[model samples]
Target: MTGCKVVAIGGSAGSIPVVAELLQALPANFQFTVIIILHRLKNVSSSMDTILAGKRSGIMIAEPDDKEVIEGNRVYLAPQNYHLLIEADKTISLDYSEPVHYSRPSIDVTFESVAQAYADKAVAVLLSGANPDGADGLLAIVSQGGMAIVQDPATAEYPAMPQAAIDRNRDVVILTPETIASFLHTLND
Candidate 1:
């Protein structure tokens, strides 16, 4: 429960089911805080937090305020039109920086920030997505001595995001959704 203090997960086009499954598989006492960034429309209001929270996974899921404290056993989603950042104090901050990779709440931005904030205590996962947004960030996480995981491209609805991360960071652990869930289950051990 103490090895990894934070988990950052990002995805796009085809990640919802995987995310749901992963969350469902986690126990109520799961040890780390989770931060998620999924590419979304700049103008639309996102119901992602509500939708995910309703899953009854025993984890609280919500969009965080600009300077909210990061807590364990909860999931925080990046708000639409804002990029979520991990402050040095281990709190969250939302930024309106111009979209990276043509998407707000870019995986790259969140991953990079957490890589620096939590360093080796961080774990990053790049799931199914249509673009290459998370590859560089995953690499950054690894460069900072954090763990990186990617969905196997063959199992992804959109292979680009996972594949990009694989291409950039060869050391990434790649697995199917079910297997990924099982792997995450071991994090606290």
Candidate 2:
């Protein structure tokens, strides 16, 4: 889809490596704002943003402070223990509400919010995870006329997440990690 403004990616369990691979493949000048929501442990400190930043192929990466304005050529990660939300004004909001699917920073919350915020100008990607957290969220994006991409179950470290999304929306584009990056690059062009 042309005029895409934001790409929301959600995952858990074995998704980190897949996320790294995808980020590494994106060109330095990629123009869409990227938001990532990964299930993480509560009360535990993680340097995930630093780790992902290390793999950056020119895109900036960081965990956004609440109310930060969304920007392109950057990747924003949802902090652990907070639900990440996209505001209609193109800013990020952090919520400490009850967890969804037994996890805070629920993929469903972020994806659904992005669907509402960006609508047809959004892209949602569902990746590897041990649970079914992201399936409904991917469907939400599709319902809003946004593009949905699900990692191929065969290539996932834990297939439940991607499989769940596929089960929910069979029409979503299914691709391996490498191909997902290639497809995203086309969107930039």
Candidate 3:
């Protein structure tokens, strides 16, 4: 692969630690714009962005505001109670529509949008989760000729999400948390 423009990661149960590990491995100057969609409770407040930022991984972690431009070297998280959509113009759009799979920040919604916005230049990673939300979205990425990586189910704390993706696309790349980071490094320009 030459270089990808964006890397969209989705996860739910038992994912925060894995996500932090992946982010920690990326160098401070990593060049791909990273969008992360994690299942969050609609009625509760979260300081996840702040918690991740406290890790001092050298990457800017934020919950993107509506219409914010997507930029490389930053990790954007979908805010609570909104479906994060990637616009064709490379801007973020938040939708307060009905939840998908009972989750507000639906991984499927973001992943599909990313597939449309970045097409072949996109990379989608489905991580540990208890539900099947990300499976279809991972397929969408693959359909667009983008790379789809699923966390090795054996290593995932909750295997349903990754396994669902694997079932949807047998050829999707499967990697452990450490290897996922290594593979992503190869895509950095």
Model 3 misplaced regions, further than 4 Å: none
Q: Residue 38 in model 2: shift from native, Å?
A: 0.8
Q: Tens-digit lDDT track for model 2 on 124-178? A: 9999998899888888899999999999999998999899899889778998998
* Candidate 3: clashing residue pairs, number: 0
Give the per-residue Cα lDDT of candidate 1 at 153: 93
Give one digit per residue, the lDDT tens place, for model 1 in 1-189. 258988888999999888888888776588799888888877766698989887765678999999999988888988988999999998888999898989888899999999999889999989999889999999989999999999999999999999988888888989888888887788888
lDDT of 1: 0.88
Q: What are the C-alpha RMSDs, in order, of all predicted structures? A: 1.3, 1.1, 1.1
Backbone clashes under 3 angstroms, per model: 0, 0, 0
TM-score of every prediction relative to native: 0.96, 0.96, 0.96
lDDT of 3 by residue, 1-189 (tens): 567999999999999898888787775687889898999887888998998787655678999999999998889999999999999999999999999988889999999999999999999999999999988888889999899999999999999999999988976999999999888777865
Runs of candidate 2 with Cα error greater than 4 angstroms are none
